[model samples]
Target: MILFVSGCASTYSTRSVEPSGFLGDYSQMRAGAEEDVQLIYVNPQADFGRYRKIMMDPVSVYVTPDSYLRKVPKEQLSMLVNELDAAIKTQLTPHYEFVHEPQAGAMRLRIAITEAQGANVALDTVSTVVPVGLAISAARRAVFGTHSSIGKAGIEMEILDAETGQRLWAMVDERAGRKITGKFDKFSKWRTTHDASEYWADLVKERLESLQAEHAASTP
Candidate 1:
């Protein structure tokens, strides 16, 4: 069976930070004008910076029992995953060694595209067939509103200890349409899957650096 799911409403982005089984209140950290990057799970006692090598799995397409992920064209899905992998590797290479396979003490990074809304083919057709005024209206709505019928994407990631298979950290994030901003605020642009991957990779690097600093401070 195939089931299709559209992107969540833009207003819900802030409230969506509560991941399944997450204990932290991420909403407090969210800024009004930006998408929230929630750290859903973290092992407080784990020394994250101790790991020297990491094994990153190919990005997977996650789907529920009633979902239609399988219906998505294989070539399109593969392209998205490839872009995601490349973005992550590019950002993380400066921070840690990447291993081709899992090994003792190596950290494993698992990532999945858990939700997606593809470009609206029907709307595109309509825009071409209908009057120019209607097309302009549609474009304006896409840029300023939830983009409920347009392309959007979400991803989830987990960091685990390869040896013990223990989860060390996890996060889930989603994005849709361009960001709305005040005239005085910095202009915010729409983000694609590759952008999301880069954002998360940088976040991980920052977290590791903080952990290393904390460890150094405690050593003496």
Candidate 2:
């Protein structure tokens, strides 16, 4: 079965940059379509799962759109961006053009997130009774078998014209809180995995790869 998934939002732990470095191949996502060429990067958001939800999880936080830098507690955002800048550069192709502003060139694209939180709740029976011997002495929080991810997050992207700012390609990446295991597909959500950093990285890699393939197919 064929599925359409879009990724836009990102919980960058680094400082924001101009996004100009990603110039090349930026047009392929909207190749053949007339107009100037520009690639815009959307700010990433963070979705949190509190309470019991945090107890069980896969990836803690998920970043959308992808960035060379991640915002952290105490660090220069630009510095962080530099660290991942190379990786991000290598990811984009050497053909497409990137523009910081929108114009008549290529169309525009937007990125967004959906349901970015989840949890695993193991509910127990809470009763109130004053029996002489052993009525309901006290309530105890027992660990039920095991509940996987019970929360979810999503993202979306849209491509528009550079000058007139017209709309073109659009995509939304979403995930339903589902239990995941091991590394390969490893992910972290909020407290479940401590900021879903690696998870977001993996998704970003996949997105870049997808863009590369599309660029090649559309290239003359």
- Candidate of highest TM-score: 1
lDDT of 2 by residue, 111-159 (tens): 3322234343321111111232112222111132122233333333444
- The local lDDT score (0 to 100) that residue 1 gets in candidate 2 is 12
User: Candidate 2: where is the Cα deviation over 4 Å?
Assistant: 1-98, 104-107, 120-148, 184-188, 191-220
Choose the strongest candidate by lDDT. 1
Model 1 CA RMSD to the hidden true structure, in angstroms: 9.1
Which lDDT value does model 1 have at 203?
Answer: 62
lDDT minimum window of 10 residues, candidate 2: 46-55
* Candidate 1 lDDT by residue in tens digits, 20-72: 22212333222222344533466777876578788988778876553334566
Error of 1 at 117 (Å): 1.7
**What is each predicted model's overall lDDT from 0 to 1?**
0.57, 0.29
Candidate 2 global Cα RMSD: 16.6
lDDT of 2 at 151: 34
What TM-score does prediction 2 earn?
0.34
